[model samples]
Target: MCNRRRRVDLIEPSVVGTRNVLNACLKAKAKRVVVVSSIGAVIVNPNWPKDQAMDEECWSDRDSCKTTKNYYCLGKTIAESEAFEYAKRGELDIVTVCPSIVIGTMLQPTINSSSLLLLTMLKENFVDSMHVYHDSFTEVDDCEKLSSEKLQDLGWKYRPLEESIVDSVMNYEERGLLLKK
Candidate 1:
């Protein structure tokens, strides 16, 4: 589940959504379920354990995430864990696709908080000018580009990334949100 609220307090919604909402999906006799998770579920301290690599076998350390104030990562970790727990108890056909930092044009009238922050920083002179921590592996990529690769593996196709950006720009323009010249 995506973090849609301004508040960082997510334990309640995370519990309700995963337990009740997931059960609802099963009751509706849904054949398959797909949860869009983040790499946050699998990664922590991006530079730690220099030789370590994460796959489906690995899970993020919730304590580490919490202590470090990686609230977003903590949220993803909990939600995905709940999904797996639910799947384990039932014959639920579920798939969790964890992706790295997702970036793309949004269809919504207003972009998400994270996206808005990035857009503001890139296009306007606001916020911190420098980040204290530098991690080479952490870089943003077009959301459509990344998702398309996974979709292709599953025999699905979507529009090109360029088209996605174009659409985003169009949406912004329509909503009177213009990029910096």
Candidate 2:
């Protein structure tokens, strides 16, 4: 089950959940317990430029988290640390997937509500209408291009932002959605 919230103090619950799952896995003698995590777990605001790439050794700084910046990274760091601790304790086999800004087809209509909103906003130049942000954005197709092959070598694949947007738009159109313009 996915848990989403802004509470910085709620890391305890995640730790507890991991413990329970690890315990169950150990009791069951499971071979693996793959954990879905985020790249944010590592790579929190180091000296690296935005264009720089990060790898498994990277780790986000929870101490730098604030209401304005790094909160998500902080939570991810704490949760991932807990998972690592569990793994070190030899509770069960653990693997993790760390993707940035997951976007793509939703298995259920309820998921990825943000991608849908982004598509709706883009369909009519809503950003331009609001005069609230940058001028001229990357096309959806362009945004999803990433080092998928590189990540795949590590047993990971990211849904490019472009692919997610296009898929969302097509899905919406198939569902009878129409562009206002």
| Candidate maximizing lDDT | 1
- True lDDT of residue 56, candidate 2: 57
Reference-based lDDT, each prediction: 0.62, 0.60
Residue 143 CA displacement from its true place in model 2, Å: 13
**TM-score of model 1 vs. true structure:** 0.65
Clashing pairs in 2: 42-59, 140-162, 144-160, 144-161, 144-162
Q: What lDDT, from 0 to 1, does candidate 2 have?
A: 0.60
Candidate 2 C-alpha lDDT tens digits along 73-147: 676777777778877888666876676654545556653535555555655554332232532345464222223
Rate residue 66 of model 2 by lDDT.
Answer: 46
What's the lDDT for candidate 1? 0.62
TM-score of each: 0.65, 0.60
Off by over 4 Å in 1: 1-8, 45-53, 105-110, 125-152, 156-161, 179-181
Mark the 10 consecutive residues where model 1 has the least summed lDDT. Answer: 128-137
